[model samples]
Target: MTASRLPQFSGKTGRPELMVILGSTLTVIAILGIVTFLLIREHAGAKETATRSATTIAQLIDADVLRTVELYDMTLQGLIAAAQRDDLRQVSPQIRHLVLFDRSTTARFKGDILLLDKHGEVLADSSLIEPRPGNFADRDYFQAHVTNTGSGMYISRPFKPRCDCEDSNEWRISFSRRIASSTGEFLGVAVASMRLTYFDQLFNSLYIGSDSTLNIIDDAGILLAQKPYLEHDSIGKSFATRPNVVRILREGSGSFESVSSIDGRQRLYTFSRVGNLPLTVIVALSGNDVFAAWRRTALVISGATGVLCIGLLWLSWLLCRELRLRHQAEQELAQLAATDSLTGVANRRILDLTLRHEWFRAQRSGQPLSVLMIDADHFKAFNDRHGHQGGDEALRTIAKVIAANVRRPADLVARYGGEEFSVILAETDSTGARQIAEKIRMAVQQLPKTEGDELPMTVSIGISTWTTQTDVTLEQLLFAADKALYQAKEQGRNRVVAGS
Candidate 1:
């Protein structure tokens, strides 16, 4: 058979394989895209939940801190009021102390309450009946009160006592009221101190995450207190220049996400100013803690998605391989069905199909189509001399020679029957067909003799061509070729003849 007749088999295998690969790839991409989109949305939700939680915590701190400041302010006001009483001077020292320090005892984390003179001299103290001789002329609260007579209650930066007192190293902040005359003349200051541990106690009651922190800073960016302090000495240190602190103070009251300058870990910082006070409370929740659960879920989902997509692709590959194998098997079956087993060329069925197909094609295109009928010479006598196997071998050799001479891609060679073969040459005229038939006849006649064979092999070929002017049908065309083949056998053996 010519290569052109068998072109369709090679091309059919790839279409199924390509379709399978394309479909599998598109499925994998869609799965990944959908998974990625869902994971992104889930991540956003985690962040939003963390933000809301931080905001709630910050609000709680703000409310608590504001209430505490109000208590301290009321205490300072009461102390100032009692100090200006003229009749209090005539009372006993114990009674005067009781009246002046009346509201101070109700304050939580109270350190000391002091009445100072205009020169910042301690006039009376809550810890002492007469008062300590400590001078507070340079204290931030005292200087602030002295500098502005109309200043409202003043809250000082975090500080440690300047004396050798037992708790002198403890951090504290002071709240003071300016003691003034009715004419607004500065008289002195009444100040109260609160331990910074108050913030620790308050923060400990809240359940922020293990890696997160709660913080309080004064308006000056001075670190007042922190829960589970990141830096032991961070208290009383001014973080005014730190980027995160600067943003917190600048925005005054809001929330943001940033990397912590202390540890370089990301955090969600939710902050709010304590009412109108010069204090801000910050709830810094660790990003890892906030998203840990979400990360775990995403990891599991991503792994499963990866496996699913890979499995799908693997299955697709297996299916494509199966389809390729099946197609190859089908092609092999089709080849066997159309081929002569002995000659290894197309069988009679294929010859008839080709003739009919080409007959119509030639009729439509007005092109000449030729058929060559070939017969092995004296096959019956040769078979009796050399056995059936030898006769079959000679027939195979003759079919090969006929196929060799008909080499055009648009031509076909097939076994027409036992010891008879056929060839179809598309668009060939009578002369061309006869020339090919003579070539096939000579090729078979020149075959090498077998070791025990009495005579060499030979064949008779007959040519029949259909042109635009020929009115013969497909059956008549084959009959004419067969008849011409008989005529070639009768005239002489091993010769070529053309049909009328």
Candidate 2:
């Protein structure tokens, strides 16, 4: 026969706690993911904004530099046209000088304009009525024109004049055109020089960040001018080997990020080639400046996000703790509700519930269900002699004995009211029920006597079993057990009796 099992609530308290932790974790992760995605997108936007701003500055420089170079080229072309005229030789020296230099635009940084003959001798000077006795055969611009007649509009690397004049120490670059005969023989060169101060003037007017720089370089990778120069005498120096410069020159025009060869600080380099000329304009914006605002914003936002996530987890922990405590309290309440207050055994209500449940199960499985109705022998006279306290004590002792003898978990011992008690034994027939009843009677009979007691305490038990063939209802089963208990009392106290 299969014994019935009691209800249990063990190991089921953590389900709500697990759900709370899992939900909070998922919520925190989702928040972090969204915040991180937003931050990354904002960082990209900051970089793009910086790039566009740099490109704009570079284009502005390109336009201004192209315009200035065009002016110099025009002056060189006019000087060449005048120098090639035989009619100008017959003119007066003053008129010849005026005619040759009339097209030159006067500017603060403008330098001497000279016409050189095939041998690099100064044939005319724009600043002087009579040409200075200066030889230019060694000059790069003069040498370039003489060596290659097709070296159209050669722009020379930065150089200083040989003289010790106050401004001669300043850096200067020359724009020169090859003066050729109709037969294509190189006759001489027309050259004009401009001081590097023109670039400083143009650069200083624009605002690129405090650490950033605006630069101009020749096609040969010679630095012509820089605003806020990185090093002393940086102008006229060759940057041909620098990785950043090489990329800028190779690509001709574009924007990129690279570490500056001078300071080793990263920068965003926006560059453009000045219209058909050998000059490139660059705007190098400091990386720190470009992303400074973004870094500050990210710091604040990340801190806030961290605090939010921590707070959420803390709240979840508190909620889980409360849920655990509540679950424990609920289980304790349920245990108390099912236990007898006086004997610490299954209460009467629980016994009834268990008996009814076992009855249906027994009926379906064809197993016998047994009930043992127990009574304290002479409980009225005993109570009159010992008072209610001693009687209660006797009842507690008898309940403990009955519970000890009924060892199976499916068996229940409960107070049936007054000095009466009851037991439910699952899967036990008449013979088994009678044997168990006799054992309960013997255990109560063996109890130690109290002071002033005439005899040892004892109990009389009556057994009733319901088999598949028995024609009895649940109420009839209980009535039969009660009737047998009366019979046991009538037979003699402390004896076990069985009912049909």
Candidate 3:
């Protein structure tokens, strides 16, 4: 009942099974590697995408700020062009009002356009108070324009507008140009006060987060205007000392990651100098907000990877199961093929295979291989006297006797054919083969009988042996043993004959 053949292959599965496990393990490793690579790529891609998007936003807003400042300067340029008239000092007050307030209807203008007289006195104002109340000089833009009549459109740093009419705490930057005579004598300064709300209203529509920032600063990094304006004194505050501003100045326009000097938050910063103006526009995005979109993408990718890992594991299990079952069935089929149904000994198919394998082993070891060819003596006569049942029983008895006499694990006894048997002895010489052949012959001579005739049974055996040094092939060895068997039958029925 025990599976002796099965035990030979027990603890270890075959090469195909090993390959399944090895291949599966490697596949899992490769999957993990791919996931790692994907995650790294996704991380880099997400950061890059965030940086580019921020830069685009910055560029768009930079264009808006540039246009706003340029328009203010263009108004000053128009005023200065009008002052070139020779008889302008003699023009009617009505005509002068037409010249000063010509650009007032535009809603984009959040500040007053003023014309100053000699020594920075506010002569005519765009806001149109009958006797315009303030401003005799001293602003940087005023000083710059008075000193150099040719100074083209000067933009001053962030400052509070000096006015007496309807006043507020709000700040505005000034854009100024000089009004001069044909001989280059400074007549006065024409000024435009750029309202802070201009920049705020422009940036308010954007959805940058609380910690995020949108600001425009002069070349000296003085805060010109900012959205979500600082409750503290950020207006007129200098940021030129910060490293981020220095880098922006050096690069002119680019995106980078940096820590904020104000909020101390890490941000992806996109900045550019506003179109030939001394102003720089900045858009800063918080780190958490920048990575938020990437987190969602990574979650989806991880979910898919988790599902794939499970699927791969399941596939490996199923494959190994199927392969193991098929391997077991093949092993069982091989066992059946090599075993004899009637005698329980090796059949002729196995005998041939075992002899070939042993022959090669003996050759390699430089040892002698011996074969015993046994035939049941007078088997046909016994079958004729007692029917086939009795004959079959006699054959069974002889098989058991042959099997019992061969003791070594390396020795094999097989039913070679009808009434013919064989024994293959490994590492055996002629004398050893002859002795075992005689023992099997005597054992067959004493087969027990519980029925019909009580006639004694015997087997005539022929022995053959060869060493690698001998000129004998496996076929030649087999032929010599068969010939010796015929001779044993010729001389007597129950003896052994050995062939050289």
Model 2 bad stretches (over 4 Å): 1-14, 106-108, 147-151, 331-500
Give one digit per residue, the lDDT tens place, for model 2 in 217-318: 989899998888999988988998999999999999998889998999989888999888889988899999999999999999999999999999999999
Better of 1 and 3 by TM-score: 1
What's the distance in Å from true for residue 170, model 1? 0.7
Q: Which candidate is the best by TM-score?
A: 1
Off by over 4 Å in 1: 2-53, 76-102, 113-155, 176-191, 218-222, 238-261, 264-271, 276-278, 286-328, 354-370, 403-411, 426-442, 452-456, 462-500
TM-score of 2: 0.67
- Tell me the number of clashing residue pairs for each predicted model: 0, 0, 0
TM-scores of the models, in the given order?
0.74, 0.67, 0.57
lDDT of each: 0.87, 0.87, 0.78
After TM-score superposition, the amount by which residue 479's alpha carbon in candidate 2 deviates from its true location, in angstroms, is 19
lDDT: worst 10-residue window of model 1: 2-11
lDDT digits (tens) for residues 164-255 of candidate 3: 54645678777888777768888888887877777777788777887678888888888876777644888788888899988987888888
Which of candidates 1 and 2 is the stronger one according to TM-score?
1
